[model samples]
Target: MSAQPESVTTPARSWFDSEDAPGRRDLETCIHCGLCLTACPTYRELKIEPDSPRGRLYLMRGLNEGRIAPSDPLVEHLDNCLGCRACETVCPAGVPYGRLLEETRGQLDRRRATRETPMRALGRWTLRHVVPRRERMHVIADLLRLGQWSPIAALMRSDWARRLLPPFAIQGFAMTPPLEPRDARSLERVAPRLPAGARMEATEAALVFLPAGTAKTRVWFFTSCVMEVMFPRVNHEAVRLLVLAGCRVEVPRAQTCCGALHAHAGLRREARVLARTNVAAFADAGYDFVVHDSAGCGATLRECGHLLDDGPDAERAARFAAITRDLSQVLAAVGLPDAPASLRSPRDPSRPLRVAYHDPCHLAHGQGVRAEPRALLRRLPGADVVDLANADWCCGSAGVYNLTHPVMADAQLEKKLDTVERAAPDVVVASNPGCLLHMRRGAAARGLDVRMAHIAEVLGEAYPAPEMARAPAR
Candidate 1:
């Protein structure tokens, strides 16, 4: 009988048996130093132990060791976290709070089969089916644009109509900017507007742009999902700035979404799938660095290697992550080109542009890119850049957190809006798409007149086509 296979006995499986469970070692790394408490937006607002980083680490430890159950209160505490990774920025012991929270949420998602509320179900379905695909995003953006431009928008904006919908849905619609007409949104249609001096070359079906002078470096642009659909203008401007800086910029249409939203929502499986797809898309494309304008997307792209560290695609993912760069970081490295003379004195020749810059949490904390954006902002001709207090604090967008947790998101948004109001900036610049959307909504809701724009948009304005500058003189 072969000794009955040695009568082997295996250990019983727990609810947290999945690979998504928090690493016990990473959890132990937290020294409960509390340095991250003040840096935490939720801790600063709620002033609670459970909401703080150290407190969350303790909860994670208890759950990992099976000392605690996945109770309603514990799950709520974890869900309340923005996953902005701001805690990672200040943790002296280098606790991997973001990874711990994400993995813990993944395990919680697997364990709680009965917890799927209608809203939550809808969110998951959309994330699984819609987000990673570029075409679906365009279709959704079109539908939204149609509603906004039609009488449907006014009807939905009414208080009674808004009450009938989910709060996040209402807030999301209110936050969106009017979309570009379909035909005008294509990159082909937009690129022709570049200055006469600009030169564009093609490589392996990717668009490469070089300044009038010799190219200093080559860069590949990671065109984001929402960026292409909703904010095509910003993408165009970013391209212009890169070409102006003597970069041989390449735009590979094969690139898709960075899967930041998937990771943030604890859909690690889906995130990994998208990460692999991105690896395949950019694998053969040759470039020194991959550039992204949105801070949230850039941060996630930089972590792709870590996301797929142990998988078959590990080496490729690591290489891709190594080359990813935020737009400001790359621009600052190559040197910020001088603004066109026309932009120098557009408002008042005597006074520089009174600009207030809001730091995106992902850029400031997640990627340590605080100095790069600020440096680029200051380089604009005649820009009197003023610092906003608590500028690095979360603007409450937190990648759809405003939709999921309106109350907490509002508190932070209101605080940020107040600071902008006091500064009285002619233009409030945000480097992340979510921050721009949230801040714009906050400013609009409060009847504030401050114009909000992406940092690239502001820089693009400074380097207008030569024809535009000569138009007035002619």
Candidate 2:
């Protein structure tokens, strides 16, 4: 990110010198188009240009040309952006807004390296230290899970607790779904997890799964770090569904976190390290595709080409990115073997399972994956995929955006929940973890009966996973 050993010549007057810096030509392509205005969640909420993609591009261009200097207001304006990439989706000129913004952030982080706010400092530490380490992340999750049921959780829920710690901390605690047991959440337990007729064989370094019949294709399952700890049920379902579709599913043992959170937070150095690790982990694994269920992680994995677009690893990164696909994309291509047929509305057996699918911004906007998920949802034996107003619109759960910019996050969340309530579906499904957790919290706070779930969970309902080995009773 520092561009210390760069190969390209830096512009004489430019403030950004990194190889990854926002390219001048990329900024000039914006055309000052307002087409992205309504699509932008922050601009829609604040009605300001600096907060919009066009305005931000102008600011980036100004800095790249040395027309302006780094300042607090500039960082605030850039920081307000959710980086959901909705702007890119609507831009006719095809401006890579997310990439440019990330590069610009890297430049600013260097300038303000010594001036991190308490909140920002904490975020940087967590992204750098905790997220990339599998064991540490699991430990933290286990602790949080314990706290969720303790008397302290009730105390934290009280109004007076806001005075003791950051409001975001309390809000995040309230938003977390109940954590699965640590024993059940382990990768060893999760990878071998299968449905009723499926079987698996464990090699020294990986687990190979065989479907109920002959395997159709080979896939390397990337179990996202957060998904495993927070939503292991969904991970199990993803593998179960994959095997059921007649694929030889392999779970690589050496893979690390996808680094989407790091890259989004502008910790590019850490992001690059994690990216290279993954590229090496799956090298020569012999798979038709590297598939994952979490949309955000899928976007990051696919963008490894750009994240590592320098040094000797560039070509390999490109190769890795090429084969990476979201869970829905692979399933859509391979097709589901059968729909469970028992997944119907509880209130009326004759009615199809009333469902609404909310598109995660990363899936819809980041990876250009919109239809695949919906198509899979439609294939459910009794499903009626309802029309969600602005289904592609972000649910204000843009990674850690809910914690970093809670006010704006809530503004967008309220509007999203409003639409969900209007649709009045029995359940709402999203592919990414953050959106599911955030929207689930909002639905519960409002006492809405609507259940928020991952697409895999709903898919699992249609095609259930294998029975689990029961944990001993206390």
Candidate 3:
């Protein structure tokens, strides 16, 4: 036989044994226009072609076509992605970059099931076991909360102690919100009071909450696992706002984590399991919409269809994804009662409370939510709503990306905090729990003297209920 070309000398052996492998259509959709380069956080940070979305697409295509084998360098390039999906927003060809990336990671994860590093193994285990379990997460939070109150927290804050700790450890410690007591964290305290003669079938169950007045919209509230423990008040305020908006909201007992963190970490089966659980939980709830306050959870909920497309719940998942709405989207659509006279800067009632809005990456790029949050903030009476520069940029809390890749995460965070300082708002609102945690810590480390809040908290401030303001504090 004549000498074969070098390209044809070896057989192309497939390595992606996972069913969710990134396919040709999504990979080939990238035009290599490089528009996504500037939009991607890693590419912008590294200024490297491989770290860019287009370059990553090429790598994914190579893996899919069996032209390249998974190696440490190749996996590192893929692992470095924040998975913020900012590239999807700017893509002209409408490549499903987020979906493709998740699927590609799924393939890699399956291949490395046996050869995983200790750190990666620990992360995967936690996502599989703990994150999907609400009670265990809260218990861990309680332990961490105890640590936060102990002298250890103060010691950790010291320059010497900080220097001793790894950057990720310090960052993780900084991101920990003051955990709430179970009582304060409970959604039961604020479940709406239904009127004398009115009741709904969904509210007949243990997890459902009712609105005081006529229900304008029926919704199932997805209390995110992270939001439940780290920022419970956001959930409370959000549920309160939903009630006040005439939403008969139900907190389903069966609903679990949205699986964004799981998917980002490449636990595809775990993500699907959680997706299936949610789809099943909300199936008979009879809600007009599935409302979520956390942007990360909201994005994951909106993608449940794609996540479960190959599974038995494919049709149900598609139906579930259709009704998912962000809290801001729902609030804007329904219109809140006027911001009360009490909603003003504590420093001086004469001056408007300056509020700045930071866009959460998943909400903006993942779900295309930008204007609604700004508009909702602007509508607050006596508040000066300000715009954040490059608001839609990822805040580097990309599903634990800050913990895994602290260097790039801190770089992105510094830039974000710089913008907040320039804006100098009394409060900067980011609608995702992860963004709230990450940026809040970043702002404090910079000594920026700013408050980080969820949009629900800001709006809840405006429309205070008897439940939130309870007797002593106010």
The TM-scores, one per candidate, come to: 0.92, 0.93, 0.93
Give the candidate number with the greatest TM-score: 2
Candidate 1 stretches greater than 4 Å from native: 1-15, 201-204, 342-350, 466-474
Candidate 1 lands at a TM-score of: 0.92
lDDT of each: 0.81, 0.85, 0.82
Give candidate 3 misplaced runs (Cα > 4 Å): 1-13, 113-115, 158-166, 192-205, 466-474
Point out where model 2 deviates above 4 Å. 1-12, 113-115, 187-197, 348-350, 466-474
- lDDT of candidate 3 at residue 253, scale 0 to 100: 83
* RMSD per model, one decimal: 4.6, 5.2, 2.8
Expressed as tens digits, the lDDT of each residue in 162-238 for candidate 1 is 77987878888898888988776666654566556777666676777767677788888888887888788788878
Query: Which scores better on TM-score, 1 or 2?
Result: 2
Worst 10 residues of 2 by lDDT: 465-474
Clashing pairs counted in every model: 0, 1, 0
Candidate 2 lDDT, tens digit per residue, 1-474?
565543346544877776578877898998876999888988988899999889888889988988787788888889899889999999999999998988888777756632578988898899888988889988999899888887989888887898887988998898887888888875456444565567888888888787876778999999999998898878877888888888888888889999998888887778889999999988874689999999999999998999888778988889899999999989999988777545677568788778998989989999999888888888788888999999988888899999988888888898999999999998898989999989988888888888887888788777644452232110
Candidate order, TM-score descending? 2, 3, 1
